[model samples]
Target: MNLISCAALAAALCISVHAAAAAPVKIVAAENFYADVARQIGGAHVQVTSILNNPDQDPHLFEASPSVGRALTHAKIVVYNGADYDPWMDKLLSASKASDRRTIVTGQLAHKQSGDNPHLWYDPSVMPLVAKELATTLEASDPPNAQDYAKNLQSFLAALKPIDARIKAIKAKYASTPVTATEPVFGYMAKALGLDMRNEHFQLSVMNDTEPSASDTAAFESDLRNHAVKLFIYNSQASDGAATRMLALAKQSGVPVLGVTETAPAGKSFQRWMLNELAAVEKALAH
Candidate 1:
C-alpha cells in the first residue's frame, strides 16, 4: 500500500479508539446499595458513583451539592429508589434534560405498586430485576460489549441465589416469629420472611422521623415486658433515646437484640453485611 493510504488508515483507527474511550458507560446511583449492584453488573466497563454513604443520615434529608450536580450531568445511566425517596435525584435528572441518559427507578418495577414500600432492594426478588434492567441499560449504551454485560449480570443473579435460599430457610424455621424494631428499615426483609412485627405503630412513627405517641410507646413497652417479642432489631446508625431504652429492656427481658444498619458496615461487602445482620436475627430467635 502507498504511504499516504497507510497514514490515513492509522488516523481513522486512532479516532475510533478515542471516541470509544471518551464514551465509557457512566452510572450514578442515589445510594450505596444501587452503587454496589451497579458495580457488580458494570464491572470494568462502567464508572459507578453514589451520593449517600453515611448509614446514620436520613436519605430523605439529603442536600444536593455541586459535585452531585456534576455527577448527574455526566451520567449515562442513573439508578435510584423512587416513590418520593431521593426526590433530589428526580429534580436533578429533570433539570439535566439529557435525552440519551436512561434512568431506572426501582419503584417502577413490576411488583412495586403505588405507595408500596420504596425499599425494594431489601425484597430479594427486586435485586435481580434491578440487575436485569441495569444490564439492558448498559447494553444499549455500549452495544459492542453487550455479551460481557450479560455475563456479568448472570453472575450477579447467581450470587444472590444463596441469599434467597438462606431467607427461605429462615422463613421455614421461624414463620410467624415475633420481632420488634425501632423503625421500618428492616420491615421488608422481616415481612418477606413471615416474621410478625410486634410494634408497627412505633416503627412507623420512628421511620418517619417523628416521636411515637404515648399510646404507641406504652404498647411497645408492654409488649417487651410481657415477653411478646423474641428479638429486638435496632438500626445501630439511627438509634435514639427511645430505641436505646428499648434495647436495654430487651436485654433485661432476655430477648436477644440484633443490630442492623442501613448502609454497608465499614469493612464488609454489601452481601456479607446484609446476610450477617439477618443471621444475627436468626441466632437471637433460636436462643
Candidate 2:
C-alpha cells in the first residue's frame, strides 16, 4: 500500500472507463440500403455490417454463410427485409440468438405478408417509418447519444422530401401510365407513381424462377411488339432467359426501357439511389 501504487491504480481505472464509453454500437443489416439508413441515423455512434452488398449478384439466389452467423453473435441491432424476400435470414438469426439483440423487419413495418412483393424499400413511405424506428431504437439502446439520434432522424426525413416531390410530380403528370416490368422488384414504387403495371403473372414467374405459360409469354411479347406499354422496366441484376429475351424485344420495338436493381449500388446512399432512379424514370417517360 504505497502512495505511487495507489495513484497508478486510479489512473488505470479512469482509462478503462473512457475506453468503454467510446466503443461503438455494432449493427447488422440483411440489406445494404437498410444498413445505410442505420448509418445515417446512428452516425459515429454505431458500426454497421450489411450482408447483401454486391450489386452484381442476384439477391433472390443469396445463401448465408458461417461468417454471417458469426457477425450476428456480436450485433446489438439487426435489420432485415422479411415477407419471404430473404427467408435465409430467418434461419441464420434463429441459429444465433442474443438476449439483447433488437430486430427491425421492413415487411412488418409496412404490413406486408409473405406472398406480397417483398421489395418493401421501393415504397417511399417505408423508409421514413424505418428511419424513425431506427432512431427510437438507437436512443433506447444508448441514452447518452439520444439527441444526436433524434437530430439525425430529422435530417434523414428531410433528405427524402425531394423523393416525395418527384413521386407526386410523376403521379400528377402520368397517372395510370402503362408500364411493364420483367420482375416485381420495383412494383411498389411503380404503384406509388400510379402506373398501370402489366403482365403480373409473367413477372411473378420470372421472379420465382418458374417459366411463364405460353399464353402469358405471348401476351407480354405482344404488348411490346404492339407498343401497348409506354415504358419497359427490366431487373438488371437478376435477369433470366425469359426476361433477357423480353428486354431485347422491347428494344427492337423501339419502346423506352429503364433498368432498375434490387439493391443500392456501391458508394451511393439510399437517398441518392432512389432519386437517380426517379430521374431516369422521368426522362424515359418524356421520350
Candidate 3:
C-alpha cells in the first residue's frame, strides 16, 4: 500500500478507538432495577453493572465482595437504594472515597428514612426522580452527548405515564380490596392501588428475619382461612420458613398468590416488570 493510504487508515482507526472509549459512561448499580433505568436513559452511552441481578437471590442478605468493591471504587457513577436497605453499599462507597464519582441514592431522593420502606424502586415516583438525577449526572460526565441523555431522560419519564395510568386503573376497579403478603415487598405499590394490606406485623417480622408472634401468625392464618384477603403477595426471593408456610396456607385457602422479585427479570425493562406484576394483581382481582 502507498504511504498515504497506510497513514489515512491508521488515523481513522485511532479516531474510532478513541470515540469508542470516550462515548460511554461507566455506571454500577446495587440493584438491577436502577441499572435498567440507567440503561434506558443512557442508551448506548453507558455501561451498567448491576450487582444484584438474580431474581432468586434474597437482597436482604446480600454481602459485599472484593470484586463488587472494586467495581464501585472505579465506577464513574454509582446508584444504590439507601435508607438501610443496602447499607453495605454505603460502606463500600465511603471506603472508596471517590471524590469525583456521582452517586444517586434513590431512597434518599424519595425522602425515605432508615426505618421507612427500603424498596423505593417499586414506588412509581422514585425511578422518574432517579432518572432525572441520572440524566443530570450523565450530562455532567459526558457533555458531548448531553443532548442524547436529555432526550432519553424525557422518553423514560414519558414511558412511566402508562404505568401510572395502569395503577390508577387498578385503583378505579380494585381499590379497597383486602390483600396481604408474606413480606411487604409490594407494600408501596399496594398502597398506590389502594389495597388494604393486612397482617402488617407478620409481614414486617418476616421481612426482618424475625419470627412472627404467635398472635400475628394466627391472625395471618385466620385471614387466609376465612378468605378475608383477595390476594397474597409473596416475595419469591425470600427464604423465610414463615413466609413459605404462609404461602402454603394461602394456596390451601384458595387465596390468589402473586410472586414478586426483588430485581427486574432478565430481558425485561423496569416499566415492563412493574406493569406485568400490576397486570397479574388486576387479573387475580378480576375474578
lDDT of each: 0.83, 0.94, 0.90
Model 2 lDDT tens row, 54-113: 999999888888899999999999999999999898898899999999999989999998
Report the lDDT tens digits of candidate 3 across residue range 7-84.
999999999988876866889999998999999999999999999988988888888889998888779999999988
* Candidate whose lDDT is highest: 2
Per TM-score, the best of the predicted structures is 2
Model 1 regions lying over 4 Å from their true place: 1-15, 18-23, 110-115
Per-prediction TM-score, please?
0.90, 0.97, 0.92
| lDDT, candidate 2, at 80 | 94
Worst 10 residues of 3 by lDDT: 17-26
Q: Write the per-residue lDDT of candidate 1 for residues 139-234, one digit (tens) a residue.
A: 888888899899999998878777888899999999999888887778889988899988888887776668888998998888888988888888
| Descending-TM-score candidate ranking | 2, 3, 1
Better candidate by lDDT, 1 or 2: 2
Candidate 3's C-alpha runs over 4 A off are 1-23
TM-score of 2: 0.97
Compute the lDDT of residue 99 as modeled in candidate 2: 98
The local lDDT score (0 to 100) that residue 220 gets in candidate 2 is 98
